[model samples]
Target: MKNILRLALRAIGVWATALSLFSAGGLHAQSFPSQPVRIIVAQAAGGLVDILARGYATELNRLWDQPVIVENRPGANTIIGAEAAARSAPDGHTLLLSNSATISINQFLYKKLPYDPERDFALLYNIASSAYIIVVNPSLPVNSLREFIELAKRKPGEIAYGSFGLGSSSHLETEYLSARTGIRMTHIPYKGVADVLPALARGDVQMALAGIQPAIPLLKAGKIRVLALTASVRDPLAPDVPTAAESGYPGLNLAGWFGFVAPAATPRPILDKISGDLAQISNRRDFKEKTIMRGGLVPLLQPPEQFAEYVREERARYSLLIKNLNLNLD
Candidate 1:
């Protein structure tokens, strides 16, 4: 009888604790972000991701009537900041403004990550995406994609390409192109975009896959020729530049995307609210124009559920591509 009573008391205690936790969670969800919110950007300031985060912070602060501060914690290919965000409380007060590197590609490129991309965070919304431009020196005598391919075939190992770094999106995409087209272009690695631009201009490298922002001014000044852009459709900013799909290379569809996320256990209502607000902001005419001017495309705003699904698809797609290409940081 004593043992029976003791077990019965323990069961009652467990039920009461569960009830209290549920009630507190409900109350916390009801009044989320009672304090200023912090957004962690996994890159250094002045980069594309940092620019987007600051812009969004301005709007988010106005909408929520609370301060939203963005903190840059760069290094380790964004794993440092990502792990910090993942370990934050699930009250929606701490958020992450992550890019393709942190959320999707890093999983396949790195041998081990401190945080699990899929398990540690809930997707809120995808803010924007941008494409890369395949640019070569104007003196190369290749103006069109077909012409470029023909020239590449003729030169083979002589046609070299430069990227920001090994295992970077540009590097992987170039490798993908080489594999698809059966052309072996020499791979030239650079420290960053700063080095890439000068190298291309000096003819130190024959060609490169660069973000549209860096290539736009150079292309317009007649310094380089744009063979094709890596987007599903032609960029309005550079409508004359054909997409890779139209250039007989439909497999070369890669774009850099940015999005927001909170800890996975965050309440659904909070995530929905953030998603809805971002959807409104992304469609504003002024916001659209600014995004275009910055060489980015305002993404088609997706609700929380749709955004989650989109990330999952991206994760799977990149995972397969990375494995097949044998891409790794080390």
Candidate 2:
């Protein structure tokens, strides 16, 4: 009789525990994002990442009926914002809006990072990607990528390239090209992209790696000529320009991407919900058009697992490149 009573009590306890877990999960699924969501942008306002984050926030607000705020925490090559996001509560209320620089490149550029790129955060979704166009002053005689390469080879170190900053995506892309093609060109670092075009126009720097959106008007105005794009395919905005892959350098394909992430311990249901909403937003025609108009590529939406894998690949690629080049900012 005692043995039977003990077994019965154990069975009751198991059922009660199961019931409590299910009830808690249901409550969590139902009440998530009960307040405003905050997205920390790792750059200053008015930058490309900021623009995309604000646009997405507007759409999310419309969908969630709650304010979705974008907070700028720019500095330390995005480490500041990334660290903030990594430390936030994993309750779906806080997120990060970041670029390849923060998620991939910074880990290698900085000697020591405050957070682990892989272990500290959960990747929610990739928002959009944009390719860089190799722009040169029209005064330069080079028309094609091959011709540009020949020119650089002839004058190795004479043709200077301007990048936004040291260890920035622009700088790394240029370095990657130099490593693969054996083309040597002097690197000129600027305070920001705003300085790159001016330096190029004044002939202070003859060549640059810049995104197509900012380069388009200048190209149209005959201020700059595009030698090649960093994407595998030519940009629709500039159909005439060939990609680096088409120009006999298949390894030069690189692009800048934007994405969202939350702290790693966020619940699976919350992640799924956020990913679903983001995928829907990415597919909206207006969103696509606006992003393209602003010089961003349409986003390739992926679930959390797939996005995490992509981030891992990028992190590894940049890590190797940075280590090989001995690139360090701090």
Candidate 3:
């Protein structure tokens, strides 16, 4: 009878402790956003990612009636911003605006990362996704993808392609295509897509994988031709261009994405609240027009856990592709 009484007391103490913690979390959620919320952007100012982050911050501020700031931390492949975010308190006041390369591919590309993508952050929502385009110089003598592949086979290393940088997504796309087709071409790395397009126009390079905005002006000037796109479905802007699936290489249809992440230990209530608020805002027409359409991105918001699984899948996919490319940025 004495032992039974002691066991009951211990159980009551455990239950009381759990209830107190639950109550504290409830209080935290009620008083959430007691101060300014910082959305750290892991890219340079004036870029598409920055624009999107600011747009989202504006909408979030409208919802909470609180100051939402976008802090840009641009260098060292997003490690600087990511580390800052990782070290922040998990009180739901801080978030990271992350991109595809930083979240997915950086793990394998670098020998050491300041913060582990999966371990340090919890996925909040995927903001947008943009498909890559396969553009070739007008002088390439190939109007279609198959024809271009045949020419690359005929010329071997004589055919060269340009990319923004050595380990950029476009470079990986070009390298993977070369791997799948069993073709060899010299890689011409450029400072950015701005440089790559000009090089393509002058016949300095044969082909490149670029997002729509960078390639549009050249396509209009007749400087380059877009033989194919990477969208699973046809892009509304360039419906005439065939998709990579139509071109018989679905793997080439990789879309770059940007999304929100918070420190991993953030309370579930705060995560759900922010996610729900953001999803409603993302579905609005004006936000879509101003941000998504202008930047050639499709608004793609999903639940946090679902987005987390998607990130894991993307990481695994990029792992193989990066390995094939032999990219060693470290």
Per-residue lDDT of candidate 2, residues 1-330 (tens digit): 999999999999999998887677667757877999998987666666777788888989998888999998876567788899999988888989877887888778877889987788788888777788888988899899888888888898899998766777888988888878888999987744556877898889999988777666677888888889888777778888888989887878777788888898887778778888988888778777786445546466766778778888888888888889987777
Error of 3 at 295 (Å): 3.2
lDDT of 1: 0.78
- Which residue runs does candidate 3 get wrong by more than 4 Å? 136-143, 146-168, 185-207, 214-225, 245-251
In angstroms, how far off is 37's CA in candidate 3?
2.4
Tell me which of candidates 1 and 3 scores higher on TM-score: 3
Candidate 1 vs 2: which has more lDDT: 2
- The TM-score, computed over Cα atoms with residue i paired to residue i, of candidate 3 is 0.82
Off by over 4 Å in 2: 1-29, 139-141, 190-204, 292-294, 328-330
lDDT against the true structure, per candidate, is 0.78, 0.81, 0.81
lDDT, residue 67, candidate 3: 98
Q: TM-score for every candidate vs. truth?
A: 0.79, 0.83, 0.82
User: Worst lDDT window (10 residues) for model 1?
Assistant: 291-300
Number of the top candidate by TM-score? 2
> Per-residue lDDT for 109-160 in model 1, tens only?
8777788988898888877776788889877988887788889999889987
